[model samples]
Target: METTIYHYALCVSLTLMLFFSYRFFFGRLPDSELYRPYRQSRRLMGVALLELSANYMVHFFITPRAVCPTIAILMNLCTYWLSVWLFGSAMMLLLDREWVSRRRFVRHIVGWVAYCLITLVLWFLLPSRVSLTALPIVLAIVFMAYAVRVARKVFLTFRRTIRRLDDYYSDDGAAYIRWMSVFTYWAVFFGAGQGVFTFVPDRYVFVWIISAIPFYTYLYESYSNYLLLYEKATDILDKSNDADAADEEQQTAQNPSQSVADNVNCELNARPQLVMSHDQEVALERGIKEWIDKEGYTVGGLNIADVARATTTNRTYLSAYINTHYQMTFREWVNMLRLDYAKRLMRDNPELPVAEVARQAGYLSLSYFTKTFKDAEGVTPGKWCR
Candidate 1:
């Protein structure tokens, strides 16, 4: 009787937590303008909750001894399939949308289906619970393999994306990456815990309770970090729009005669010109350099969007201006400025430590700083200082 009560209590608590997790995360996103990925996450969560409820109902309400085993096997397989799909979807959404190809997804589905079919076939053929334990152990091994692959892909995607963005070293970006790392590690930990519980069911209860804490904790943290990144992107768009409006107003007010010429040029170049006007490009370049010097933005985490906001220009214009005038990506351009700043600092304060120079120069990683400095200067910071 106590065992039955404990089982039902655990099921009820998990179900309630799932309900709140869904409500807290998905409820706040507006239905009218819901992002497709977020909607998919909500649906996955719903399916997961339904699978849990179905499993609970099968265990609690069904009393027929002859059919209970069969039903249990079916429910467990369904639950496992849903869980795998949910995990795959989460990996694709959180890491990189383009990472998972259609062929890969179809292959995953087929593999999982085969696993489920084989487990069902073996369950009735082999009457021993000890024999059935092998199925879960095999499944756990498969899950761990998949988790490792996803983690590797996520790390590569993160590094590549950071290199493309201007504010890669900013506090928010660092926090976002940290949360993602936590999420990936927790996922691996959960897989290992599941494997342990499968092999040794005696401590299943304790493991389940303990695992739930970190599972939800990291899951929430990952989602929160994703939302923070989304908010930052939205702010950049808003600022860009404001800046464009302000520029147009000022241009119209200051040069009424030139406004007609500007309008004609805009109309002529409405098809998106590869090259910007020489005069306009030069002015933007000068303004950006002056702003960077005045604000000391060479310290890491300085993005083109931040510079655009300060210079009252949009990202489109700033990117084009930099590419045309500087012949480098935003990342390269910023690193060049930072390296120059570091060199100046080293020359002036010969006693300053190399690590301190890297920190002051806006480098988040000492190794990365050392590598970049050596690549640009053809010598280590220490050697350069000497």
Candidate 2:
């Protein structure tokens, strides 16, 4: 009875903490075509859900003998580490294209193999030697510190990228931001899991209770990700369906089998023109294109001030012009220019390699170019070029 009560209270507390964590630090989804990545990333959410559900089954349904709880704990720890490493690899591959560079990818794979070998050796050598000792506690602290470092870097990088997008790109930026948060939460929660066991000492039940925090965290986040993804997808589907219905209505008004694109154009013609400014903004747009097309200056070296100087405008005005005229932030506008140029190069000069085209198009790094291109074009540079 006492054990049951203790477990119940622990579960309650853990649930409350998770609820607040999400409330305070959760990410929002975007409301536009940019949410396509978020829709695609539902695969990750599905995998995570499966893993979390499996964990619960192991803990609750398969109650092993208490005679070897220590061994069971060690096995659990090793398996958890393996799972974390795998999940981290997936995130690095999906979130950051550069992570899969030839050298880094090989190194990561080798490192995982080594970790597995070491884990196997340790299991045979000291299978049940794990204890609530000073060493474990110290290691836990180190792991937590590593987690903090990783989390800081991930959060800052994500924030900077998102901030570079203007209002038009905010939806896509929001989706990436959500993904970053999900990955960051995974890192911090698991890293902190080691610390929980350290402090809980010989109280096996308490160790399990503390460990449940990360489990719950993963479960809730994965569930939320799936829900948001489905919601966004459904919203898009409904809008597309409404557009089809309107097109059908127009077709009926005219001749049967009239095209939807024609009806869309008809409807679009009725919309009011967006007001334009006759200021430094229009000049800046012309300057950016002229400089890129004529001078062949690479985008990596170009900044707001540089473009402003080329257009004989101030940085503030150039930035505002990009936002107002192009419906893009400075970074988005630049990327759009580069992507457009890349597409042209690809289509015109099919003989050139994608990387060479990227270079010629003013992209600094082919990896970054590929990622940005895929983000914009919905396909790899090679595929799109083909």
Candidate with best lDDT: 1
Please give the lDDT score at residue 350 for candidate 1: 99
Candidate 2: segments with Cα more than 4 A from true spot: 1-65, 68-73, 86-110, 123-153, 166-179, 182-187, 198-386
The local distance difference test score of each candidate is: 0.59, 0.52
Output the TM-score of candidate 2: 0.41
- Model 2: which residue pairs collide? none
Q: What's every prediction's RMSD, in angstroms?
A: 10.8, 19.8
Clashes of 2: 0
Give lDDT tens digits, candidate 1, residues 261-281: 656766664312334577867
lDDT of 1: 0.59
**TM-score against truth, every candidate:** 0.53, 0.41
